[model samples]
Target: MKFNESLFDNEQTRKEFLQTTSALLISLSALSLLHCSEEAPQKPSKNLNWITTKPEKRPVMNVAYSPTRILLKNGIIIDGSGKPPFTGDVMINGSTIEIITPKQINFKGTTIDCTDKIIAPGFIDAHSHLDWILPLDGHPELKNPFMEQGITTTVTGNCGYGVAGFMPKSKYLAFIKNIGKGFFSGDSSTQKDKFVQKLAVSLTSMQQYLSYCRQHGIPMNMANLAGHGTTRMSLRGYESKPLDKDEMKTMLYHLEQAMDEGAYGVSFGLQYEPGIFATNDEIAEIAKLVKKKDKIVTCHMKAYSALSGTYPLKPFGTPHNIIAINEMIDIAKQTDIRLQLSHLIFVGTKTWKTCPQALSIIDKAIDSGLDVQFDTYAYHCGTSVINVFFPSSFLAQTPQIYEDKVALLKLRAQLELIVALLGFGYNDIQIINANNPELAKFNGK
Candidate 1:
C-alpha cells in the first residue's frame, strides 16, 4: 500500500529491530547445541571414565615454641607397661619421654599444667599404613587426628605395603625428595641422605628406620615388620611357584639380614596374592628364622568363614581356607615361635554360635604356653582397596560369583564417600610401594 515518507521511515526502523531479534535467536540455538555436544554420554562400555580435580591446598601455620621441651606437671602417667597409672610430672625432650617423677623437679623447660589430665605413652598403632597416606611433611589434620587420639607412634608396612627396601634406589631418592620437601624445612639434604641410607639397609629389614630414629633425632619413633608377601614377590614374580635352591638361599640370607637389622618380626598375609601362593613348608622355613631371632610372626590368616559351603573345596575337611591359621598354630607348636593373629572376628563370625569354641582353641593354645595373641579393630566395617574384592581362591567362591554386584559396589561407594567427607581422595589414600619409585614419589606429595 502507498504510504507517506514518515510511515516509510518508521517501517524501516521496525524491520531492522526484527532482523536483530532473529539473529540473536539463531545464535542462542547454536550455543545450546554446542553445550549439549560437550556433555553427550558415551556408548555403553566396560570402562567408565571419571575425572576428579585435586583438592585445595590447606593453610600453613607458623608454629613456634618458646622452648622445645614440654613438661607435664601433676599428671597420671600410664607408661604402656601394662602397669597401674600413677600421678607424676613427665618431661619430653625432643620426642623422647625424658623423665617422669612423682614430685616436681627444677628443670629449664616450659611447664604445662596437666593437673587432672590422664597422661599415657602415646597410643601405639600396632598396624598402620601411614608411610603412604600421611604426607612426610605432615598435615595438621594428619598430625592432629592421631595426636588427639594419643597416638605418638604408628607401625606401618603392614599387608605387604610400605616396604622401602623393596624399591629401587632411584625410587627411594624420589620418596626422600617428596618427603623432605613436604615434611621438613631446614637441612633436608642431610635428612634426605640419612633417610635413603636407612631404606637401603631396611630392604633386609626395618632396622634402618629404627636405627635412623636412634641416630639422627627423630620426631617420632617407629617399628616395622618384614612382609612375607613382599619378600616372596621380590624373589619370584607374581607367579605361583616354589622357591628354587639358590632362591631359597638368597631369601634366607635376606631374611637373616632383615632380622639382624632389627625388624620386630615377619608379617604374613595368607589371604593376599603372592602370600596365597606360599606353601606351608615355605612359611615354616620363614617362621623358623623368626623364632631364631626371637621375634613374633604375625599373620592375616586365609579364611574368615566357618561355613562348610564357604569352603573352597567340598568334603576336604582339612580346612584348606583356614590352612594358614592351622599352619601358624602348627608352626608355633613345633618351632615355639610367637604368633599374633590379626583381626580375629571376621573369620570367627561366620560360625555364629561357635564363636566361643573358636576362641577356646586360641585360649587352649595360650594355656599350653604357646606364644600367640590376636588383635581387632573396634569397628564392624573394614576399609580395604577395591582390588581386594577380587577372588583368588581356586574354587572362585567370592562376592564376584554372586549376581548382585550391588553389595560390593555399595561397600566401595561407602568407603569413597566417607573418605571424601573426611576431606581426602584416593590420592590421599596411600598405596604401598616397595620397588616402585613412581608410587613411592606420591608419599611426599
Candidate 2:
C-alpha cells in the first residue's frame, strides 16, 4: 500500500505505523531505523578554536602543592547522591568538600581545569572478598582490577570467609596445610603462609585486623563483616552441630567485640559448613544481639544445595529459595535485626523464573516493617572451594579423607549425587587449578 511517510515524524505516529505493519515489513523497518540511529553526534575536539584562539601551551604549574585546598573548576558535578548532574566548581579544603557552586568564588589554592570532566564520588563495591587479595605477594596495591572500574571503597569479609578475628587454631592450620599438599587442588600454600606469618603474632581480633589494614596503606577504604563460619570455628572447632550454652556465650561475646571494634555487621554463609549446621534457635540468638546493637545481619541463606533443586538435609529444611528467604525474614521478624540478603539468587530452570515472586516476598516482609536489604554479584557464575558443597561432617574430615580409601569412596558417592542433582556430566565440572603435576590432567576436566 502507498503510505504517507510523514506519519513517522513523532513517537505516537511511529507506534501506529509499527502496529499496522506486517511482521516481515516491521522487521525491515526496525533495521532501517536502527541504521539511521547509529549516527552519533561527533565529539568536538579538545583544542576546538571556539574555546581558545591559539594552540594550547604546555602547563607551567609546579607538580607540588603547599596549600591544603584544591579547586576543581568548570565541570559537571554529579555528587553521588541521586541528584541530577550540573555544571559547577567544587572546592576541597584539606580532605573535605568545602563548596560546590556555579558562581565564582575567590580561593587561594591549587586550581584544576575540569572543562569537560565529570566529578563524582568514587564507586563502592558493596560485596567483596579481599582475604586472598590482601595477602597476595609483594603487597601490590589492593583492587587493581576494581580500580579500573572506578570503585574506591570495598565491603570485605563477605560470604563467611574473613582473614581475622579468629585465631588459626593449630588443628585448622594443619587442615590448611594438608589442603596445600594437594588434597584440594585449589589451596595455595604460599598464600596461606604469607597470611599466617603476617597476622600470626599481631592479629588477634577484628579490631587488630582493621588496624592492620589501615596501617598497610591499602589503596581503597574497606569495611568488614564478622563471618559466622569463622566465629563458629573459633568457638566450636569444626563441629557441625548446634552451639551448646557455653559455646553460644563465647560466640556471642566475640561477635559483640567485633561489632564494637568497627564491624559494620555479621555475615553468614549458610550453604557452607558449620553455618549450614546452625539451628534456627542459634541464628536467632545472634540476630537478637545484632538487632540490640543496631547492626546488620548479612546472610547467604541456607537455601542452595549441592544440586540447585535439592533441599538441604533437615534442621535446615528446604522446598526452595523461598523458604530460605522466609527463614531470614523470620529472624528480622522475631528480633527486629536489620537484614541484608547476600547474593540473593534463584537458580535452576524450575526455580530461576520465580525471582520476581521471591523478590515480592521480600517486599512483603519490608511492607510489614522489617529492615531488609539485599545485594548480588554482577556475573552469571561464582567461585568457591569444592568442599563448600559437602556436608559439614565430610568437611571436618577432609584432611583424613584424602588418604582413606573408604572416605574417598564416600566422597566419590557424594560427588556423584551432586553431579546427578545438578544434571552435570563429567565434562561439566572443571577444576580451576590442580597445582600438583600428578593431577594436572584434571585441571580442564
Pairs clashing in candidate 2?
A: none
Which candidate has the top score in lDDT? 2
TM-score of each: 0.58, 0.70
TM-score of 2: 0.70
lDDT score at residue 296, model 2, on the 0-100 scale: 86
Over 337-390, each residue of candidate 1 has an lDDT whose tens digit, in order, gives 999887664322223334465577788889999988887665433433223322
Superposed by TM-score, candidate 1 places the C-alpha of residue 140 at a distance from the truth, in angstroms, of 5.1
* Displacement of the residue 435 alpha carbon in candidate 2, Å: 5.7
Q: How accurate is candidate 2 locally (lDDT)?
A: 0.61
Can you tell me which runs of candidate 1 are displaced by over 4 Å?
1-71, 81-83, 86-110, 131-135, 139-144, 162-218, 307-324, 347-354, 386-445
